[model samples]
Target: MADPKPALVLHLATGGEPLLFALTTEESGKLAGKLAQLVKTGAVESVTTKDDSVVAVNFAHVAAAYIDDLARKSTVFGMHA
Candidate 1:
């Protein structure tokens, strides 16, 4: 069996829950670059998730963003550890 894919995690400066998106490493890298550019220019961008959900993100509110590539332990509720 193949291993599960990693997720792209975004932490907002507004002090709420971090946003998680299902994305490949390559996709995550591209998105990270885009986010950085948006931050530099103080712009808002719309991102499409793996699930086909469109999310509008304001880079100014993003505190941190990274690809979560760690091996995750399974939980009872099927959430990532």
Candidate 2:
């Protein structure tokens, strides 16, 4: 069988339970770059997720982001360690 694909993890601190989303490799890189640009330049009107979820948050709410390339233990859900 073939191996599973990696994901891009976004960690956002929402004051309560943090908001987490898993993005694809391509999306992750693009998001990272855009976030950096927004931090340096201006704001982003809106953004979408891998699951087609739309998200709109202030640039200051972005806590952290990472690319997870490790193998997932289960195939049912695209989750990683």
Candidate 3:
């Protein structure tokens, strides 16, 4: 029998536009469960897959702060690269 296609996992953080961070995925469901557990600790946007790669982004208060800071930093740096 043919094998099932791998799924890309993604975790969306709260506060901003819900950015999906690339996470790892496998045939087993352990990673998905783990992601759920983490999301329970804070406001999680969603869980998704793309191109057969798991993606997970932490959406805690610290995550929001970091994203904001990162945006500011990028703006300051400009689109050089």
Candidate 4:
């Protein structure tokens, strides 16, 4: 068998914003479509990535939201980006 295909994960948001996720990738085309919808609806920001770096289109908003989200989750030691 060949190696699994790398996911085409688009950046959603980062910096511990609430209700945000890292390198978002849906399992199927259907899920991808839904994700695109979310982006269009302002539920998430568009992320562009190159190599290991990620950039968020709505950085300030996303940063605040993510920080809040991580505090609430409190899975700091358990989760890795």
Candidate 5:
């Protein structure tokens, strides 16, 4: 079976709910880099999620962004196994 894809998680500064975009590890890395650049410029950018939905993100409003690689099995205490 193929491995599960990772998700790109974005937390906004407005402090509501976070945005999630499913993608592969490589794609997540690429997007993360792009977000970093956008954040530096405080630009508004559009990102395509796994569902093929386009989301417009304002970099100035983004607090944090990361990849959620769910394939990594975790222990009871949330430590990677």
Candidate 6:
């Protein structure tokens, strides 16, 4: 079998549940860089949730973003893009 893909879990500063996203290791890293760029350039208006929803998260609202290596074993549970 092929290697499993990586996944990421984002924790927002808001008083709600955390958000989970399935992405390759490269993608996750790229997102981190992109977030940093957004923070610096203020180029992003909103972010798209992995669950097909749009959320408006400014730099201040981003509490943290983590790469969930353990959860990488599971891939979208039969869902698609």
Instruction: Point to the candidate with the largest TM-score.
Output: 5
Query: Which regions of candidate 6 deviate over 4 angstroms?
Result: 32-57, 72-81
Q: What is the lDDT of residue 5 in candidate 3?
A: 37
Instruction: Residues 1-81, candidate 2: write the lDDT tens digits.
Output: 455344544455454443555565666667765665554453543556668777775655555444454455543334433
lDDT of each: 0.67, 0.54, 0.36, 0.36, 0.71, 0.53
What residue runs in model 4 are displaced by over 4 Å at the alpha carbon?
6-8, 12-26, 44-81
What lDDT tens digits, residue by residue, belong to model 3 across residues 1-81? 343333322223333343433333342344444544454576544444434544344446323211112212233324212
TM-score of 5: 0.66
Clashes of each: 0, 0, 9, 7, 0, 0
Q: How should the candidates be ordered by TM-score, best one leading?
A: 5, 1, 2, 6, 3, 4
Q: Report the lDDT of model 5 for residue 43.
A: 88
Candidate 4 displacement at residue 15 in angstroms: 9.4
User: Model 1, range 2-78, lDDT digits (tens) per residue?
Assistant: 46566667778877887887865656667765666676675787766667677787778778666565356753334
For candidate 3, list the clashing residue pairs, or say none: 8-49, 8-53, 9-53, 9-54, 9-55, 10-55, 22-55, 23-54, 23-55
- Between candidates 1 and 6, the one scoring higher on TM-score is 1
> Clashing pairs in model 1?
none
Candidates in order, TM-scores: namely 0.61, 0.47, 0.29, 0.26, 0.66, 0.45
Q: Which residue pairs overlap in candidate 5's backbone?
A: none
Of the two candidates 4 and 5, the one with more favorable TM-score, higher being better, is 5
Q: Which 10-residue window of candidate 6 scores lowest in summed lDDT?
A: 72-81
Q: Tens digits of per-residue lDDT for model 4 on 1-81?
A: 443332333333543423433332222232344544444555644443324455444433331222212223334434424
Cα RMSD, each candidate: 5.0, 5.7, 12.2, 12.8, 4.1, 7.3
